[model samples]
Target: MQKVTLYTKLNCHLCQDVYMMLMELTLETPLEIDLVDITHAHNSHIRAKYTDRIPVLARPQSEVELEWPFTMADIRAFLSDPAPDS
Candidate 1:
């Protein structure tokens, strides 16, 4: 299983779109999705980092972070690979 985390905020259309995409991807892939709402995060650091970068996709323990404007193809490729590309 692959662990996935999405940084997001409330009422963001882009973030909502990404959330829906992630849900759809689940039918074809094994992804454990965790959503982080920067709007109400307890951690100030996390809120600060993703304030303007909502809809970012991150895999735990991997340095690679996917920002907005990513396609379903990009998500598919990322889920299929275990390691972050160098």
Candidate 2:
């Protein structure tokens, strides 16, 4: 299984859309996604880091993140390959 963190926020349409896309992708691909609400007070630093980059998907071990404007095909590629430093 590929484990990843999804940075998001409340009331964000894009974040919600990405969350659903991840869920749908799980039906076909093996993905363990951890949802993090960047708007939370405890995640101030995370919020600062991804404030303008919500709906970011991060592969923890490699520290690779795929920002928005991505597609299902892109996600498949991201899972199967090491992403360029981002």
Candidate 3:
């Protein structure tokens, strides 16, 4: 299964939207999502990397990122595309 990482923060409306969209997508797509809270890991370098980009979706193996304000079509396309070689 494809691995999806969501970099987000609590009480973020955009993050909430993304979460809902991801839940809906999970109903049909076969992707495993890992939700990370930047606030809880504030000192971590990963948190710094996505500080201003909460709600970002990343396919670590593919090094692909889908930032917030993304549409369902964008999510669908990302899921359909082949993961990039490591």
TM value for model 1: 0.88
Q: After the best TM-score superposition of candidate 3, give how far the Cα of residue 24 lies from its true spot, in angstroms.
A: 0.5
Task: State which candidate, 1 or 3, has the greater TM-score.
Answer: 1
Candidate 3 on 1-86: residue-level lDDT in tens?
67788898889989888888888988887778888899898578987888888889988767789887789899888877787725
> In model 3, what are the clashing residue pairs, if there are any?
none
Top candidate on lDDT is: 1
Q: Alpha carbon lDDT of residue 71, candidate 1?
A: 98
Tens digits of lDDT, candidate 2, 1-86: 77878888889899888888889989997888889988884957887999998889888767778999898887778878855433
Q: Answer with 2 or 3, whichever has the higher TM-score.
A: 3
Q: Sort the candidates on lDDT, descending order.
A: 1, 3, 2
**Model 1, range 7-65, lDDT digits (tens) per residue?**
99888999999989999998987778989998899999999998988889988878778
lDDT, each prediction: 0.86, 0.84, 0.84
TM-scores, one per candidate: 0.88, 0.85, 0.86
> Which structure is stronger by lDDT: 1 or 2?
1
Candidate 3 vs. true structure, TM-score? 0.86
Rank by TM-score (best first): 1, 3, 2
